[model samples]
Target: MMSVRDRLEEVFERLEKRASDERVYPKVYWAAARAAADAADERRRAGVTLGPLDGALVSVKDLLDVKGEPTLAGSRIFRDRVPAGEDADVVRRLRQAGAVIIGKTNMVEFAFSGIGLNPHFGTPGNAIDPKRIPGGSSSGAGVAVAEGTSDISIGSDTGGSVRIPAAFNGVVGFKPTAHRISLKGAFPLSYSLDSLGPLGRSVADCIAADAVMAGYGALVSTPYPLSGLRVGVPRGRLFSQTEALVADAFEASLRRLSALGARVSDCDLEDLLEQMREATSRASIASVEAAAIHSDWIETRAAEIDPRVQKWIALRLATTAADYIRMMRKRDELTRAMDRRLAPFDVVALPTIPIVAPLMAPLIADEKLYNKTDTLVLRNTTPINQFDLTAISLPIPDVPLPVGLMLVARHDQDRRLFEIALSVESALPH
Candidate 1:
């Protein structure tokens, strides 16, 4: 077996030789990672394992603080902000579990856009194809794991930040129920929707990192029995406009699950989805909260901020307190409504994104295309956040490009969702 030190050395070599030229990782924790690797190696030799994450290489999104460094959250505006006094809760937990903290990955500015373009810090290209966009705001986290520079990468999923990148990079991304992992020391996007998540090469990889970060203690989740498991499919708005390839891959995965004795049926969520959309017609919950978070800088530093992000947040500055409050109330009522509606199924499955990683050139050149694509990319996964559900995106096997099979369950059903994912993951073709 290779020593942790040896693996760390190889990771360094890969990163040094990577085509993205360190764009995927803006900051590499060389000294700290070396110390952690050495410590893990000693523990391994002493037959003293800290936990499942012992010796694992982990990368965190730039949105997370790593003690003494400012949490940039992929923006240039905060470059001179006060450094953090402590590590983010998830970072502290990963260290406690003996995982080697590799570095900080790039992300969308303030984690606002799903298209993963970062004009401030060059966006990390898709791991599968360099010319394609790497989905984000968790862009670098996804690329790092996909490119094997990190075994597991941590990201925040406000509205498919983690899953979008994972889907584009062909990896597993798990978004736990909101608040399952502490967000202390992480920069805020949408206080209501932001949730810390992990992206990795497999369901088990995510499971290990999730267990550690959520403070669940060291444990392996047993796969839920697939036979007779009820799987629901929300076949309306969420399913509309999906690229043929993504839709076909999703349907094929469903058939494979059915063959494994799982029950699959369509569950209509259009009415509930319509109601949620209507409630937020004025402004999304994320934009309104983000506007408040960056209120001081939105106008004074408008030119410094990403125009796409600024436009959305600036528009929300006009959101009446009454409108925001009413939307929140409606969202709560609808969350419960969806929960009751989903009670019959173990999980609801959908494509994580409707399309593959798009070429970066066209999106960069055309503002209209960028906006349309951003909305479409986030369309499928955003609803899960609005309803406060736990979800995971599993890479479908044998696809030319990456396509994610997203599984969702009611809030607080995180472990159940993982167990189901494990079963579905094993049954899918590799």
Candidate 2:
């Protein structure tokens, strides 16, 4: 059997070969991998113990700055942008933990769309079915991890960017508690909601990445058993739009959890939809913050951005000041309500993305289809942002395509959520 380092070298060679053929992203860098291998060898020579992620190949999303690499965020608008002087905070941490930074993966332009269609860089196809999308704006991040080209891939999730692609690619993806990890050097999507996370092949892999990013010494759990944990099932609109396959898979997941001795119960949040509506009614934090970040660029380089992204930004720019204020006020109220509601459960479960991955061709052609699918894709995941809660999307089995079962915990209960996830993941069918 090949060692992890040897396996990574093979993956790098294969990915470099594929890069020439597919043009999945704009560029690939092998220097980072070489550096990581060197460090791992040094540690071995000194007989120093290594972390679980030692020698693991990690991929960074294009939205983030890797030292000496341009932060494209998948747009031609920044084609001539200079390389970053330093690594993004998460990238620095990963390197320090003995993981190799492979290269910057592609994303939706400025991390905008759920469909992952990049007019500038060609979109990465789903690992399960190449004809369909891998989901975005963490598109290539998911592809890199799922294809075994990288052991873990870092992505920024404002809404469903991380989870959507992870679900589409049949991998484990985690969005840590908002603000849990530093965002320095990361290109902003939605400043208030953006979170740096990872996509990996297993829950342990995801946790390993999280430990590094969070600057935790180790992932020491209190060993909470699954038997008595209360898993809340939010009743109503959360599942109203789910397709039959997702519905069945989600139901089966609940049964599996129950069989593992979890106390699964229905949680009634009569105001859930109303609160979500109110929070997003006027100007969402994402829209307003995104508009703010791109205000100057939108004015000077309006024609340079992808038309769809430009239109979305324009809509945000057009919002009245009152709209922003109203949304902020309501967002606070909704956050409080969600906190109160989720207090009793260890984790609230929902589908990561209500619908499966859709083809990029049709969505790129028809704006309406794009909007509809985009909204549905981010619906479940976005609520966590609204409440400022920590959540994780675990992939479910027995589905033709990848689907995620979202586990949401109360505000600031991130560790608890991760612990619950570990237990639930152990009980999930392979």
Of the candidates shown, which would achieve the greatest lDDT relative to the real structure? Answer: 1
In TM-score terms, which candidate is top? Answer: 1
Q: Report lDDT per candidate.
A: 0.93, 0.82
Error of 1 at 104 (Å): 0.2
In angstroms, the error of model 2 at 22 is 3.6
Candidate 2: clashing residue pairs, number: 0
Put down candidate 2 lDDT per residue, 343-380, tens digits, no spaces. Answer: 88888898888888877688878998888888888878
In lDDT terms, how accurate is model 1? 0.93
Error of 1 at 188 (Å): 0.7
Question: Which TM-score value belongs to model 2?
Answer: 0.95
What lDDT would candidate 2 get against the real structure? 0.82
Model 2 Cα displacement at 286 (Å)? 0.7
